[model samples]
Target: MKTDVEELTPTRVKLTVEVPFDELKPNLDKAYKEISQQVRIKGFRPGKVPAPLIDKYVGRGAVLQEAVNDALPELYGRAVEETEIFVLGQPDVEVTELDDGNQFAFTAEVDIRPKFEVPDYDGLEVVVDDAEVTDEQVDETIGNLRERFASLTTAERPVEDGDFATIDLVARIGGEEIEDASTSGYSYEVGSKSAIEGLDDALVGLSAGEEKTFTGTLVGGERAGEEAEITVTVQSVKVKNLPELDDEFAQLASEFDTIDELRDDVRARLGRQVKLQQLSEARDKALEALLEKIDIPLPDKVVEEEISRRNQQLEQQLQMAGMSKEDYLKDEEKSEEEFDKDVADAARLAVKGGFVLDQLAVQEELGVENEELSEYVVTQAMQMGVQPQQLAEYLTQNNQLPAIVSEVLRSKALNLVVEHVTVKDESGNEIDVDAVQRELNGETGETVAADDTDAADEAGVDEADTAEVDTAEAAEAAEPAEAAADAPAATAETAADEAPAAEPKNEGAKDA
Candidate 1:
């Protein structure tokens, strides 16, 4: 057997195989035996008929067809192995030559892995923002917490801001009642902007038992852009009463016994959340900067595949939302051609980014440890409110476990990259890495005692001084995790290629 491969594209190849009569003889003999058992013969017992006798009885054409049918798969398999083609899917084969007592030849076309070099990734310069937690951020979080614990009480005056009012409403278009246009005793908040435009203003001065009417354009309902007459009758008014920010209130609101303790907890939580956001932003900036510096050529087929998948996802989402593809195009202010063009550009960027990251992972020898993957699975299960075993079962059933594991490994690799990079703030100052991490964990000013206002102020100054360093570290920590989450997992074949064949890199594989 002889095999020849032709380059169709960077990621596609066509293999042509030529088999001589010697290689085809075994399959021919097997085919004769199989066909002999299935046919009826007048003078011979079943499975006892000779090939020459059967040929004379069944005709040469019928025997040759059976022989060819049995030989094709073995020929194809040999062609794949001899050519060393890493096929992505099933091959399309066409027989070019098959004559009696002559060479048998066929051509198989397929998509194969492209050969490419990993780009240089070491000592690449990337700048990240400072992950600092601020007092204002803490206050905002505290305010939100207070609102969550606020109580509502009946009010004896006209409706006002933050006041909930129960009312009967009727809407009419062009002096005619529209379908599903009326509701009784619907509760609404004045100045809370909960109702359609002009409705709040229409109810502002109305007391219980008072009725009023207003007109406005429907902003975004089924009747969007249509002018409608709205009549509302105020039935009752209620106002929210927030508890005073006192020690007793703090004890009631949380596990803390004092207002100071609650304030500290809120400040810590806010700081951590802000730190995480800062880290995320810094990582994105670093990645963008790195991508700008590197010019990578991506396969067109990869981009097209990504775009097709994206469009399918978009269509599914639209359908779930009770919208049509045409409706989405209108909402996006685009034609199908325009949408495709935009998606194609995005797909190209996505493919390039994946290639770059994979190269970096390889160059850096970044990998996920088995323990880390197990921890990730546990964390994800907790977030989803399910048992770890249940989550594992679901992933396995869906054939997604390997993909998930790869994602975890990719994240670990990115984090390794971040750890080695230097980070500077906007002011060219170095930041404290540990403090930044704590902030990202949402524990900013919590360590400072409530009475130690001076220490808190000092910490803030230190945070500013060390902003750059922290930003860099946070970027290093966050980039891989975010990238891993966003990236699509490799298929089984790709994952197999990625995994070390001689020595397993992860504990999961070792266990398996």
Candidate 2:
């Protein structure tokens, strides 16, 4: 067999392969054997029919076609191996020649990963905001904790913001009621504005048993976005009573014996959260800097596909939220043209970033270990609210394992880049990204005091910190893959030859 490659473009190639009759014998024999089991000869048992006899019965052209169909995938793969081109998507294949007993030839044109230099990523610099925890932030965190343990009491007064009001509400169009939009005895915060429009404003200044009717638009249901008459009758108004911030309050809310200890724990937790946020920002800025330094040409087809996918996903989410594109654009304050351009730009960046990181992974000899993959799967399952085994089974059954591997490899490559790059805070102070990561992972020599351990844990630091860290880690780990999710399927195992399937051996034979 002989194979030749033609450079159609830097990102694409055309391969022409020629094979002599001798190399075609194996596929021909297999095709004949397969055909024998399907066709019944008058005197011979199934699988015992001679090839020549079957050829006489089922034309040699049909047999040759069958053999060629069976051989093309393997032959194409061999040509690819010999040429050693980084093919991207599936190839466009055509059988160019078939000299009955002498030679066979075909051509395949495919997109490929363009060859480019991955520049030195070390010394790349980016600036992130300082991870400084302020007293106000700590107070706010503690205040939220206090609110969690607050008590409710009936107040004989008008409804007001920050007060929980128990109300009965009804919605009607021209005095005809909309059942789904109406509820009885629902409790809502006056300032939350989470319910229908005009509901919050109407609730204020209303006492118990006092009712007022206002016009508001229905946000969901068959009459969504349509205006209707809303009547809200307040059953009662209750004010939240927060416990006094004292040693007794600390003991009641947490295991801490004093308010000072509780405040200290809150400050420390806020500090960790801020640092994690800083790390996340740094990853984004570092990646942006790296991309700016590199030049990579994205395939137009991949970009277009990604844009379409993103649009489809957005449309699905908006549909589930009962919103139209016009409503979404209005809410986002973007015109259709601007939104379209944004989608296209984002798609191109996603494609280019995938390509760059992929090359970087190769250059750095990065590999994904089983443990790493398992951790990734588990983390993703947690975010998706599914069991790890169920998610793994779904991914495996859908042939998505390669995509997952690619994602992990890209994540490792990004991490390597982040480690090498110089990241500083906005105040020009050089920040230690590694130290922050260690602290988040609880690897630092900092341990909760034995007596304060349960108190601190009960104060909500460990749980909230764990959740925040998992979120940050998941976002950083999955960002690349999520961005490139719609890029061309580039894994070798999934690069199907796209050759045509075999034809029926004969008219009277079962389909092969």
Candidate 3:
């Protein structure tokens, strides 16, 4: 076999391949066998038909076509391996020659990774905000803790802010009610603004047994974004009573014996969270700096595909949240043109980042061990709320292990860059990346790690809430991996993330 590569562009190549008849023999034989099993003959069984007889009946051209179709992929792979070119996307293959008994030839035009040298990332500097926990933040955290344990009692007065109200809502368009948008026995918190617009304003100053009509835009359902006249009847109003922040309250709410001790613990927890935010910011800023140091031409096709994918993902999320594109744009304060430009910019950055990291991984000879892959799978499973075995099975069935391995390799490459880079807080204090990593992993003794549910309980937060916060943090930390799982424009990209490990069933709850 002979292979030659022609550079069509810096990011694309055309490969010409020639193979001797012997290399095509195996595929031809296999094709003959397969055709024999499908064709019927008078004296021979299905599997026993001779190649000559079948060829006479089925035609040699058909056999050749079948074999060529089966052989092209392998042939193309061989050509790629021989030329050592990093191809992207699928190749546009055309069989140029088929000299029946002599040789086969074909040409493949495909996009490829542009060859570029990895820039030195040493001494790269990024500035992050100071990890400072303020008194107000601590107070707010403790206040939320108190609210979680607050007792609700029936109130005799009219509805007001912070009051828990039990009400029935009927939504009507042009005086005709929309059943899906109407619900009874609904519990709403006044001033929460979690429901449709104008609900809170109308609910306030209304007493029990009082009904009021207001105009609001529906947030969900098929009639989302449509204006509707909502009639809300308040059935009951309740006042929330928070326990006093004293020794007795501390004992009831947390393991701490005194309010002062509880406050101190809350402050420490806040401090840890602040450090985590700082670290996350630093990682992002460091990546930004690294990207700015390298310039690589991106394949237009890859960037366009990435942009389309991001738009599709965003559309899915907006649909799930019952928001329209216009609503989302309004909320983001961006025009359609601006939103499109942003998506394009983000797509280019993501594509370039993937290319840079992949090259760096190659340059550094980084590899993903089985143990490391297993650990990453487990972490991702936890974040996705699925069992490790189940996620593993899904990945295997989808042939996504290579993408996962690539993701890990890219991560290691980025971590190497981060390690060599200089990160400092606003106050010019040099941050210890290793120490921060340890603390984030729950190795430091200074404060309880984000994953410690027991510590959360001691600090007057529910174990479930703590777990939720930890899961959110983990998800945020794994965004790049998640993006890789969703994207397919890069070497490490996969579309498997679009398929769920398990389909979720709706529990049939009405939206408020």
Candidate 4:
């Protein structure tokens, strides 16, 4: 077997492979066996028919096709391994030679990872917002907890902000009543700004039994866009009486026996929340730093495929939502040109980030351990609300395990970068993400370094990588003769590889 590669672009390549007849003999034999199982020959048992007779019956071309089909994947994979190209998706294969007992030659063209130098990331500084829990913030947290223990008391005074109003309503569009648009005995919090527009204002000054009428657009149903005149009657107004802040109240609300103790606990909780936020900020900032510092050429075909996939996904979602692209654009306040350009730009950022991380994974010699893969599977399973076994089966059955492993490795690579970056708070004090995480988890040593490899990292991938064809389908082009020969033959189809979660880290001011 001989293989040679041609560099088509920084992100793509054309591979020409030559397989000698000796190497293909095994596949040819396998193909005969496979075909023998299917075709019935007179005076020969099914699957027991000899190769030559069957070939005479089914044609020499048919048997040759079967051999080529079974051989393509192995040949393609071998070529890829030898070339060491970071393939983004599937390859386009063309068989140029099929001389029996002589040689088989084919060409495979594919998108490869872009070549780029990772910028020096050590001590790459990013300022994050202050994570300090202020006294006012503690007070607000305690107040929210207090609200949970609050009791509603009927008030003698008029409706006001913070008052819960029990109300009734009638909606009429052009003096005609809209049935579903009206409700009675509904409990609404004044100044909450929920429900119909202007309803809060209409109820603010109304007393019990006082009615106010206002016009607002209907949100749904037959008269969805029509303006409706709503008449709201306040049945009663009640204010929430929060529990007193004292020892007894503290004991009732939490395990703490004193208000001071409760305040301390609230402050600690707030601190942890902010610490999580800061950790997230640091990770985002680290990735942003890398993306900005490094330069990579985006593969045009890969980008176009990504954009197409996402657009298809979007179209599918819009269809499910009973909307068209035009309707969706109108709803989102975007023009077709703007939406397309945005898609292209976003695709570039994503593909570039992927290339960078993939290179980093290579540089660090990162490998996805079984434990890491198991953890990733568990996490993904939880998110999808399925059992681990079920998710594992699906992923394995679809040959998606490699893609999952890649996802896990990239996460580790991202974490590796973040480990070297300097993350500081707004106060010019360095933010020690590891130390905080250790404190929060009640563990010691280098734990926070692993925080960035979370699935939450992939939150904003609504329009990413939808253009990836099934792995089986992608490989099919390389071995089409075999595919046509099989009658409902089962072949593994690899699912689209998901992008490892990443984003800009410093959207807000540096954390303190």
lDDT per residue as tens, model 4, 206-242: 8998999998887666887689999999999888777
Per-residue error (Å), model 2, residue 443: 3.6
Query: What local distance difference test score does each model get?
Result: 0.62, 0.74, 0.76, 0.71
Q: How many collisions per candidate?
A: 9, 0, 0, 16
The best candidate by TM-score is 3
lDDT of 4 at 158: 91
Show pairs that collide, candidate 2.
none
lDDT of 2 by residue, 1-512 (tens): 89999988877789999999889999999988988999988999999889999899987888899999999999988997788676666689999999988999999998777778689988899998888999889888888777667766789999988788889988999889999889888877778777788898999999999999999999878898899999999998888777799999899888899999999978877776667667767766777788899876666667677777778778777776656788778877989998898778777776677787787877876766666666666656555666676777787677566677777677677778789989999999998887767665573333321112222232222332322112233333542323234334332211112222223211221111
Best by lDDT: 3
Clashing pairs in 3: none
Ranking by TM-score: 3, 2, 4, 1
User: TM-score for all predictions?
Assistant: 0.67, 0.79, 0.84, 0.75
- Show where candidate 2 strays beyond 4 Å: 40-44, 53-62, 312-328, 378-397, 442-512
- Rank by lDDT, highest first: 3, 2, 4, 1
